[model samples]
Target: MTEAVHLATARVGDLAAVMRVMDAAFDPLFGEAWSGAQLLTLFALPSARVCLAWHGEEPCGFSAARIAGPESELLLLAVDPAWRGRGIGRLLLDDWQAWASAHGADDYFLEMRADNDAAHLYSRAGFVEVGRRAAYYRGNDGQMRDAITMRQRPSPKSGD
Candidate 1:
């Protein structure tokens, strides 16, 4: 049997590992990559939270989000290239939703380039197309891409 991957709340100190995963996961053509300094600035916000999924001693994936008022936005999620097929993205999604809910978020949101293949993953997670931004991102290939914004609300528990 395979050992379980552990999910932990990541701190700003974990930025290096998170960046490593982010850099490995996103291609420059996607235009969704963030710099180390930008990530540090984001983490300084009290409403922001980062979670890391670790397989034993190796960092496998991470998710970052900021919750404010009734809404939460998933800013980034990245899994190491060598670890893509093992459900880490879904794991991070679940944890992000739980954390956001605990912090009083009722609506979850995320936006990505429409061409991104992760749309299926988000759709499977209950997110739906809420809006779009035209020519929202500039790719390294010098092309513009539309951005699809997705939203989801957590389903109530039976006893709740």
Candidate 2:
């Protein structure tokens, strides 16, 4: 990323900005974008957390996740298409993992379409495929796609 970017806890008041990034980042063909009302509801959940990435005053990306007990699940991650390929997605993932860890998470989990390129990002971050559900998501194109579930556990320290 050429420009400096930063992340902050996102509030319900930041819905418009978050939605802007989501609408631009997610392909409508995949039907992966959540509605504004759905997002609002998510903010009301006590276990859910959201982080918004900003480039100056503009929202460039966002990540949403939920933690329960020792596990955390990534619900969404998006970076504005115009600002992609600049490590924004990776930053979001790192921030989410950090937040989860600080909040008592021992394992991080996420599920995405089997064909989603984001898998490479997750893989590089130490997430391994744990399970899959065939024909889990139906796209707007009427084709069904498998959902791949991945998990990342804390790496071993220098000493046992």
Candidate 3:
């Protein structure tokens, strides 16, 4: 694997840049139906934690999640196409898991469009598909898409 890139906690001032990364990563799947502002609002909740990944000074990836009670939901995880396959996503996830563990989260969850090819990544990370919602996403083309919900439980001693 390439040298692991630097991963750090996201600051409030980084919202705009984070939104840009999310918009670029999700647009192909959701199309122009959702705006960056909407995405930001969804991730801006108090329980949310966002992390940014950088290769030197350039922003290359990001991931966001919310830890509430004993559960944490991964709202988004994206990497610049040019930076894919470099283990950046895994690094970002490792950071997120650590953050969630520190915040008392024992379970992690995420939802994705059923057709999303990146679902494999979640599977490879040990996330199991627990449920599916049909016709959950309305694409820009006005077509309906299904959503798959996945979850992962941290080892009892792992997160503590």
Best-to-worst TM-score order: 2, 1, 3
Misplaced by over 4 Å in model 3 are 1-4, 32-36, 39-46, 156-160
Work out how many backbone clashes candidate 2 has.
0
* Better candidate number, 1 or 2, judged by TM-score: 2
True-structure RMSD for candidate 2: 1.6
Tell me how many clashing residue pairs each candidate has.
0, 0, 0
Query: Is 1 or 3 the stronger prediction by lDDT?
Result: 1
Looking at model 2, the pairs that clash are none
TM-scores of the models, in the order given: 0.92, 0.94, 0.85
Error of 3 at 66 (Å): 0.3
Better of 1 and 2 by lDDT: 2
Best by lDDT: 2
- Taking the tens digit of each residue's C-alpha lDDT, what string does model 1 give over 11-90? 88898888888888999776688898888877788999889888887788899999989899999988887988788899
TM accuracy, model 1:
0.92
Query: What is candidate 2's lDDT per residue for 1-160, written digit by digit as tens?
Result: 6359999999999999999999999999999999999899879988898899999999999999999998999999998988888999999998998898898987899999999988988999889999999999999999999999999976676895
lDDT scores in order: 0.88, 0.92, 0.80
Q: Higher TM-score: candidate 1 or 3? A: 1
At residue 73, what lDDT does model 2 achieve?
A: 98
